[model samples]
Target: MSSDRLRMYLFSSMLAAVTAIFAQIEIPLPLVPISGQTLAVGIAATILGSRYGAFSMVIYMMLGVIGLPVFAGFAGGAHIVAGPTGGYIVGFIAAAFFTGLFLEKTAFTYKMAIIANLIGMLVTLTFGTIWLKILLDLSWPAALAAGVTPFLAVGVIKALLAAWIGIAVRERLKSSQMSFGKAA
Candidate 1:
């Protein structure tokens, strides 16, 4: 691989590791525990943009599926990906990709990042709620209450914080003449 590709791969791997670490910091909820995973997902996209961000989440999922304990509460195995929260884990990929795609397509302003992250967050909630409903055999209302409502406030906070931190770090990197990608 070229130097740039190697750099991106390495960085993506690091983000994956970060996601795993965040996953371990879990607050036990009824079925799904709140974790720092989403925050890391947004941060990964902010730092890596669309392609690499997606790549990082893919790597993260792979690690979890392979029983690497890279998921929330250090619990990992193929079963995790096949359980009620499986859809949420899969949603992580979508969140990272779309969030990065929006930022990549826009001016990377705080406003734009927040919008992107919000959309990304919705994607996650939709996927996760639907999956949670199907997996747990519950009505839509139960799914929404169990999987969505409790998460909205915290999710918004995480997204905004990630956006702010990302913009600040990106600005610092740019000012220092550091390349955040192959093009730079």
Candidate 2:
């Protein structure tokens, strides 16, 4: 394999490890337990962009699927993916992807950044709530109760924070680029 490919692989593995660590920091709500994993997801996207961000989450999920203790409460394996939170886990990838996509398309101003993170939260909620309904065979109302509604407030706050951080990083990168140009 090429050096670049090897580097990417190593980076992705590190992303997975970090994501798993973030996943463990949780506040168990009655419906969908709140976790810091989403923050990691946003950071991964903001730092790595869409492709690598998605790739990293894929690695994270694969590790969990292979029985690595890389999930909330140190849980992993098939049961985790097939359980109530499976959809949320899947949502993580989608959310990250959208966050990166939005940032790539628009200038990373504060408003745009907020919009991007909001998109990420919506991505998670939509996919997660749909899956939750199907997996549990619940009506729309019940499914929403089980999945989306309960987590709205916290999700918004998390999205806002992620958006702020993402924008800040982009701004810093831009400033650094300008400095390098001037130095050259």
Candidate 3:
């Protein structure tokens, strides 16, 4: 493969690994614990943009499905993907894609990143809440209480952090001429 293509692959893989690491950081809750996976997803999108960002999330999900203890609480396997939190896990792909796409269409500034990450957060919550409702046979209110309401404040915080840190790192990478490819 060409050098740039190789770099892109490497960066995607690295972000996948980063997501795995971030998954280990969690705040235990009754139904769905808050985890760093979303934060990592935001960062991946902020730094890698649409195609590769989503690709990285796919890689992360595949690894977890293959029983790589990469999900929250070091849990993994297809069972996890089909479990209560599965929707959120699956949502990472769309979150990353849309988040990066937003940035790609706009600018990679901190303000734009914040907006994109917030959108990504909402996407994830929507997926998780719906899945939670379906799987647990819960009412909309219950599902929102269990899956979405609990995550709002923390999700915003994580989004802000992702935007700030991702932009800083992306800027540094750009300065070093090692941004993997385009301004992703």
Best by TM-score: 3
TM-score of each: 0.94, 0.85, 0.97
Reference-based lDDT, each prediction: 0.88, 0.78, 0.94
Q: Model 3 misses residue 91 by how many Å? A: 0.2
Instruction: For residues 110-174, write the lDDT of model 2, one tens digit per residue.
Output: 77767887888889888888988999898999999878887789888888887777667656856
lDDT of 3: 0.94
Top lDDT prediction, candidate number: 3
Select the stronger candidate by TM-score from 2 and 3: 3
Give the lDDT ranking, best first.
3, 1, 2
Residue 94 in candidate 3 has what lDDT? 95
User: Candidate 3 has which clashing residue pairs, if any?
Assistant: none
- Could you give the candidate ranking by TM-score, starting with the highest? 3, 1, 2
User: Where does candidate 3 stray beyond 4 Å?
Assistant: 179-183
